[model samples]
Target chain A: MGAILEIKHVSKFFGGLAANSDVSFELAEGMIMGLIGPNGAGKTTLFNCITGYYPPSRGEVIFKGRKMNGLEPNKVCKLGMARTWQKVRPLAKMSVLDNVMVGALCRTNSLKVARDIALEQLKVVRLDRKADFLAGGLPIGERKKLEVARVLATRPQLLLLDEVMGGLNPAESEEIIQLILDIKKHGITQMVIEHDMKAIMRISDRIVVLNSGEKLAEGSPEEIVANQAVVEAYLGSEH
Target chain B: MKTILNKLGNNRGFSPVAISLWIAALAGLALFPQFVDNPYALHVMILFFLSTIMGESWNILGGYTGQYSVGHAAYFGVGAYTTMMLMQYRQIPPWLGMWAGVAVVMVVALVIGSICFRLRGPYFVLASIAVAEIMRLCAVNLKDLTNGAEGILATEIPPFKIGATVVTDFLSKVPFYYIGLSFAVLTIVATMLVQHSKLGYYFQAIREDQDAAHALGISLSFHKNVALLLSAGFTSLAGSFYAIYVGFIDPPTVLALDISVQIVLICIIGGIGTIYGPVVGSLVLVPLSEALRSNLIAQGIFKLGLASEESGVGVFLKENLAHAHALIYGILVVVVILFMPDGVLGFARKLFTARNRGNA
Candidate 1:
């Protein structure tokens, strides 16, 4: 299908340092694009630029057919793009249902309708049983799930997840992989920033590797694994 | 007791008994002026209603939206001055002038919100205080518009009328009492509507996490401004009511930092982000302060035989107790913060639940 999101040579400079430099990519509709990078690889910075958390110092972010540069994050979200933070930020003082209801409220003005959408998304993440529990009191695994459920309630066409499984156990990571696959079945485009190699390979339709704020390589999973440059930049020369 | 409390707090729907209780309470309040003739008692009741309006208004922004502005007096003072100016200098009656006050307060809120909402945490607090201080200074210096620091004294309120008939002359405290009561109720109902609506959810989301709320399509500036406008509007109403009731306006009385802090204390001492928090807070604070100001507490001590009438302690109590209300308020706030971080209402709820468990 056609591309749903396009990053055209995007670069972000914080004072003298370049957090992201000329990173270019396109996320095709209904596809899972894995963004793998080493530490300080500018993955999260790129996500911030694309999601309008920060305006890129250079280049453009086109969502659907509109230029998204310099737009606020809320405006970007309203235009069918949503993102989750690297550190799970749940509305701690609010209940799980209420937290998700806030996301669903983007689509409707009625609290009841927002609540129903929240409940439906909660069930998808298997968090329906903890609907009344405060978002802040949940364990990390559950907080990750809550992050997913909340963004899902927004009904975004493109979802960007930043290190969602960073601290998750093997079993939890597996569950998230399955969840990502399930989301793909819904035909929503996704860009997953992850450090876990096997999990990324299993879910991504295409893989882009980044090293020190620039794209190292981009290809199918097998092509990326066999590419000497990607292996050297990501796994080191000894690998 | 547990069952009754649960029935009262139930979210399925309003219980019949609860509804009846509310109606009865409202009816009693509406008819209170008929049976009471003591001006002091009426004055105290009006003060209670004034406190309720201020607390409820502050609770919308500071409690629900987590803006925690300590500069609400800017809106309060602006409202008072606007209404007073129009009534004293221009020919407009206060009833019409209060709406003008609300409109003026909205513009002030927008300017303040734009300046302060850019800063978060302690910075936001500081910006709010600075803005309010600036407003207070402006009020003090603007001689032509605000009558300078000399203040304006409204000699008399015009009579209320409907279609050629005078409804009530502003002779006794009765008219002011009803007006205060109605505005207080209006603020309470407005708060309830906000808490149960989608706007409340967005506000709370911004409070909990700004970035996450933004990622969910809730604009921080937009919602914060909305909260401030609503809060400032109600607070302006309280200001207009106070100005008209007391017939006096000055920088210290209406626009001081103390007034702003008092508005916030009403919410913090009751419970923030809950419907009845300000109500409970106002109920506790107004009577306590009134008693202290009137030296009733010292008299109660003497009457209860805790201190002899002619003793040195008695002399001290009678001489200094009335002026020590501020000190007492400070100590009370410290005690509440230390022992009950959730405020009086939350502390009471916790105690009740623990007692119920013990019985079980």
Candidate 2:
């Protein structure tokens, strides 16, 4: 079977600096691939390039057997790709349910259908309790969960989760871990970028570690943690 | 009695409190002829309606989306001049000319919006201004067609008479007054529709975060462009009406930078991003300025007196009062941004939501 998303030798440069250089990876059907990198390893930049926030200076991104090069974000979404931001971008004045409804609006024009789907998404994230509250009023944990709910509302076939576990407590992390697992159970392909090793190791079927804009290693969870180079890179950064 | 009150409010097209206030204001406006039958008063009132419509037209784009444009007169001028010349050259009735103006302006707006809607924040605002100025210059220099700076005049006929009432006379202005008022209402209702629709949610999302809106596949360009079209259509209609009511068309009156800025000011003062604010702003600012000018000119017994040789001081005071409205508007904007941030309707909405929560 073909990979849901394939990034082959794609590089993006900002004037003199290469934000992403020869970065390549793929997500298979129903597979949760972990994209792990230190700050500025260009993980988010690579995501942006794939998602058409920035066009790659060279190379191609293939999504679902189509050349996904320089496609606008909305078109990319229409083609069954969705992403959650590292920072929650909920409409501050809108209720949490309404925030999700914006995403649902993409799938259905009917307000009732959108609202129903939004509520169901909120239920998946355990945010049904706060459905009527303003999104901006949510605490950090709830906001993070709300971002997940927002993406879910879009009903994407391939979900890109950016730092969904970045600043959560262990319990919140565990909750998201189960949510990711449940999402995979529903046959959605997932790619999560997280620094939380425990959560990543628990949920990711495969992990790709990036350092200095290059893919350092890609392997099973245990292999990534056991790789000599991965250990060296983490220790070298300490020095 | 409660049912009767609710029915009366529904008929009046607003809540009871708002309906009564509107009725009282209209009564005050009708009684103005007793105090001043002057053309100046009529002139000011006509300007009032134009500003009101421009401000309300702006509500769809600026107020709803929170994307500010300071160059709305581009559409207004397009509407006014396009229909004005159509009527002058072809002997087209101004009634038909108004619709033609609306169509022309909406097409132009769709094109402009398609190009410029991709830009956001201050970039969008700048593009709107530059485009409006370009059109202004084009209208001025398109000499053979536009009569260059010399403007086209509608061959005047008395107002469509109802049993011997020639109400269309610019001097009478009552008919013009009602026309402007209703157009303003139409703009408001159109805004209210956008606000209530799923389209409104898309606008709010795009305003708050563009990437998020796209992630949801709301198609920002398409929705924003529609908003700009709706806004342009009404603004152009007001412009065509201006040509008919003023019975003369000129570049400055239709396309000036001040005219664009005045709409923004009206929206800001009345309340930015609100359906009711523009109309309220117009109602408050427009007549007050007119009344102030006349009052300043007429010295009262033991009240404030103007002491200018050329009546320059009186004009200065009157103009200052207009400027003062802007000052009040600016301060009000700061206050709203700092305190209410949601705007007048936005604030009211919040209160309603909170009160509803308590009731529930």
Candidate 3:
């Protein structure tokens, strides 16, 4: 399958500090691409650049043959790219269902229709039972699920998930891994930033490792595990 | 009693019962002036309607959208000045001038939104107050147009006419009452439509989290401005109503910081982000202030035999309570903030839910 998203030599600098430097990657259609990196590896920064939260200092983010440079995050989302924050920010006072409805409303103007779509997405994430509860009252595990459900309601062709599994326990993480696999079955392209190596290795069709704001290695899961440079990048960071 | 009230308030969407209650209320308000001929009563009702319009308008942007502008008086003053100036200087009728006021306020809202929306939190609040202060200063100093501190008094309001038939002259308070009622109803209906529409969801999302909303394809600046425009437009209408009905327009009266604070207080004290929040706020505030101002509460205390008229407590109440309206108002606000941080509606909801849990 052809690439659904192409990031060409993207670089984001914040006042001379390079948060992301010369990062390049392509996410193929219907594939789960795991983006693994140590702390401050510019994973979230790259997600920001792709999602148009911040314009890259230099580079092109081509989404389905359209240039996404300088577009606002909302415009980028309209073009079939949606992202979650590393820190899940749910509409605190709104009900869990209403929070998802906000995302679904982007696809349709009718609240009734949006609610239906939102309910369906909540079921997909197994959060349908807590639909009436305010998003603020949910625990971390549920909130992460809610963040995923909300973005999924937007019906994006490409979803960039920033650390959805960060603070989750092993059981919750397993559920999310299964959820990601299920999302793949639906033919949506996903680029996930994860710190949990085992989880990323289990779900990713392809793995890309980053170190010091640059792409360190890119390959299949087996090749990535075998790559000497990738191993060194991980071990060196521990020191 | 609490459970019954909770059930009624919790009934979401348009059930048959809700629709009937709404129609009955609207009808009652429409026919109020015919049954009541007293001018003082009519004047108080008119003030109630004006307060409702201001509160509801402010609620749109501040409550729903989470853009708490303490500088709404800028638009209010602009609206009042626009109508009063056109009427006084060029012989334009106020009915025509009110629309002009709305138009000017829209432009003013856009300009203010562009500047203030860049800042967030308390910074945004301070920026709004600063902008409003500048407008008030302009009104005070720009003697050429605004007529300076002496203020503009509407010596006459041209009789409202439709096709050569006089609808009503400005002679009776009843005409102003009906106009105020209609404007109040218009604002309430407008707020309801927004609450049910896609716009309301976008506003709430932005209020909850701007970045998250944007990632969901919600344009933050665009939607925020849309809210402010709607809010400023209706608030200008209220300003126009106040100027015409009171027959006075001054920087102190229309453009002061107190006017803006009062608008916000109405929303905050009632309950923010709910349709009836402002309505409840106006109902509580307008009457309480009036009663306090007129020493009616003190008189009522004596009449109820709570205290002898000549007793030390009664004399103190009679002497101090009338002059303590502002102090009492301040105390009420502090109490509400401390005990009921979510305001009255939210506090009531919590109580109802707790009671239900106890029953369960």
Considering lDDT, which of the candidate structures 2 and 3 is the better prediction for this target?
3
True contacts kept of each: 0.92, 0.77, 0.94
Most accurate candidate by TM-score: 1
Interface RMSD, every prediction, one decimal place: 0.6, 1.0, 0.5
Ranking by TM-score: 1, 3, 2
Candidate achieving the largest DockQ: 3
lDDT of 2 by residue, B1-360 (tens): 667767976654458777667669778766765677686766777677777788888887887777788888898899998888877888676777789989999889988888888788899999999989988898899998888788887776334655687545544666676677678667776887777678988888877787788777877788888788888898898888887887787778789887788778777767776777887678656775565555443333114543543477655655565446545555655776577655555577779989999999
- Candidate 1 lDDT at A209 equals 88
Task: State how far residue A68 of model 3 sits from its true place (Å).
Answer: 1.8
lDDT of 3 by residue, B286-347 (tens): 99899999999999999899999899999899999999999999999888878878878888
Per-model lDDT = 0.92, 0.81, 0.92
- Using all chains and alpha carbons, the TM-scores for the candidates as numbered come to 0.96, 0.85, 0.94
lDDT of 1 by residue, B134-211 (tens): 999999999888888999999878899998999988899999999999999999889888988888888888888888
Q: Give Cα distance to truth, residue A50, candidate 3, Å.
A: 1.3
Q: What is candidate 3's local distance difference test score?
A: 0.92
From the highest lDDT down, the ranking of the candidates is 3, 1, 2
lDDT of 2 by residue, A71-137 (tens): 9888888888999888778788788988999888888878789989999999999999999999989
After superposing candidate 2 on the true structure, give the runs of residues whose Cα lies further than 4 Å from its correct spot: A237-239, B1-49, B157-171, B295-360
